[model samples]
Target chain A: MTPSKQEILSVAAECFMEQGYHATSIDDVARRLGATKGRVYHHYASKIDLFFDVHREGMARLFAAVEPARETEGDGATVLAAMLYAHALAVLENHTFESVVAQGVQMHRFGATTPGQRSTLDELIASRDHFEALFKNQAAIAKKDGSLADVDISIAVKTMLGGVQWSLIWYRPNVDSSARTRANLAKQMVRTLIDGVRTRAALQQDKPERRPSRAK
Target chain B: MTPSKQEILSVAAECFMEQGYHATSIDDVARRLGATKGRVYHHYASKIDLFFDVHREGMARLFAAVEPARETEGDGATVLAAMLYAHALAVLENHTFESVVAQGVQMHRFGATTPGQRSTLDELIASRDHFEALFKNQAAIAKKDGSLADVDISIAVKTMLGGVQWSLIWYRPNVDSSARTRANLAKQMVRTLIDGVRTRAALQQDKPERRPSRAK
Candidate 1:
């Protein structure tokens, strides 16, 4: 809750995101803050506690932002639009956290041994499940109302999550293509999901401007 | 190649796939092979080299299988069918290599810092470009002949590649889904490429599945 602790957590999240958990050390976190290890130790019991805070904070912010849209009285499509727009902004705001969580997924598949690493992993997974829970409930509601197509929420969740998480690898927030510009691509994603890029109706007559189709 | 070296590469690939690159030590591979570190180090200069060999071998096998598909005389859709089928099998066969390569992509972005890692990255990128080259050419031919829908080959390549590569993270050979099941899925993928999933006619339909006009 202290000002110095908040500042340290912010820098530590950046280092962890860029360097990874195994490669990172608490000393590096302290060094980035121009502080001593003793100072960090004073604020936090251990590195694991700091990592948990980062994971928890990241998830809490995302869920809080999307919760309003999820609770709004609108069609499923509108709710999805609101949720995705919020996701895009969150991804843009915390680029490092998004990338770090992705690395955490790989680390999770192979369990980490250190108490710090394991605790971080558990918190990360719990956050992910919570995020997915929102989407799953919305998906169920939409499906029941026929605003969403019939599809397995599990597979669809992975695909949707894949698009969002994986895009972070390629998404460059340049001055020309600002976070908002990259976020505009969300429309295309929404179009692809609701109407489907290869929707049966869309393919009946080849649109002349459609990009080169790869069949073979 | 000597049989021992080839065997070592194969075992290393499996170990890396199952346990991940950072988690799976050279000792683990040796143990899996029922050999000692002496034998492994004798063959591979380092763990990175061993992993690179596995990546190269897996990629070569993938391209070799798809060569027939690329050269086959058929419409774009048919050629794509062959390409998809070949990729699906190779994917299941090289699941471990596939996963390691996936992790390698992340590691490369972070701080891989080794000759073998760089070389493997180059080779993998080149092989993917080569595969895309074949698909693009076939797509052109299909479009010229009116056999396929219009699409962006560049984006299509990303989607198909991402779709297949991402599957490695979740695919389990022990599952009830057989190769035949995937083969059908691949075929459907090909079909969707030629015909968009939603079609214009479907969008224009005025009624639900059972609703009929009274013509009053």
Candidate 2:
């Protein structure tokens, strides 16, 4: 396929992801794209601009994947399952950008940014907050309904988020086995978290270590 | 007061934490301690040496505080409570080294290290794995007993670790309100994590946005 603007973003993301935001110069990104400095500048004003654009593109992809299902008629469990599935898939297929976003988030935290970067970061954060609110409310509704077991929605939300964020530590999507493993891992997390995996019913259905203690 | 070796490590940790490991020079640290380069180098052979020493010292303080109690005649919940308390105290007090350790660990993932740094990092990581295993076993035993509710031990362990690691982001020891606030936060995490927090439980038992959840 011809290198469109989206294609350029993809290539640039790889450079930023590999070399880090500050270390990656625009000249290198342009060269990687098989384009010149002027062409790169025409598309993106600065290195930081491309970095934020990549972040924006990433967040948009994430939100696009989950947002519709969240608005759908699915139950909380179904919706969370869909969300986790999409997230896990993204982690598997998009290792470089996924890792970049995680590290860039830390850099963004250190209060060392140009005004342009900060403004873009602010918008990115708000977008994330909006995304999180969707999950929180979904979990909250699940708690209210009998679909979910007893748990704090607030902390549960955090755990769910952390589970996704921290997985960048070990998630390698290039391998086929990794995809299934990650998908199962995420699905299992939802099941155990929302349904209480060690519930009396599950205990009764288990082996000794996995047995349920509450079923009379 | 005359600066002790402990004082030197403490001050060095602060500089490393604020300025980052590669970014900080020993001279900057010496200046902070009102000591000359000779004194600092005498205590620590090289910058890497100094960084590793502080890292080990912080880890030792952490393990020391939590080890005795876990080995004592306490159940997992009790032991975990002790560990969490110790952990929060460590983050609040040993801010510098923990920050450097966090940086060092991040650097490790990218192969950004000499052999000495990697070896020391391996040691630190092994110890951390040990702590994680300790918590995992504690949770497992607690789950088997009636002391803690049934949940995935892995999820709980990661969240507990994430909570402490994240404290490096917002934990400011000089702030008086946060001291009480964080202690309670740590305790609340312990409570809800091992045992499910009933909706009827005190609201103070849960904090807002434990780990960047989507709470609106």
lDDT of 1 by residue, A49-109 (tens): 7766766667777777778778665666456646755775676566666666665566567
Candidate 2 residue B197 Cα shift, in angstroms, is 6.9
lDDT of 2 by residue, A1-216 (tens): 235778778988888765666567899888898888787788888888788788888777777767666665555555665665566556546666666665556566664787877888888777767877877887777666544335556555654555455555544455545656766656544443333323332233332432368887
**Worst window of 10 by summed lDDT in candidate 1 chain A:** A193-202
Off by over 4 Å in 1: A1-3, A71-78, A114-120, A173-177, A199-216, B1-3, B18-24, B61-93, B112-120, B129-160, B172-216
Q: In angstroms, give how far residue A196 of model 2 lies from its true place.
A: 6.3
Interface RMSD of each: 4.7, 6.4
lDDT of 1 by residue, B122-188 (tens): 7766775676687677666665655544455544444444444555655565672686866554444
Clash-forming residue pairs, model 2: A132-B214, A133-B214, A203-A211, A203-A212
True contacts kept of each: 0.07, 0.07
Give TM per candidate.
0.74, 0.73
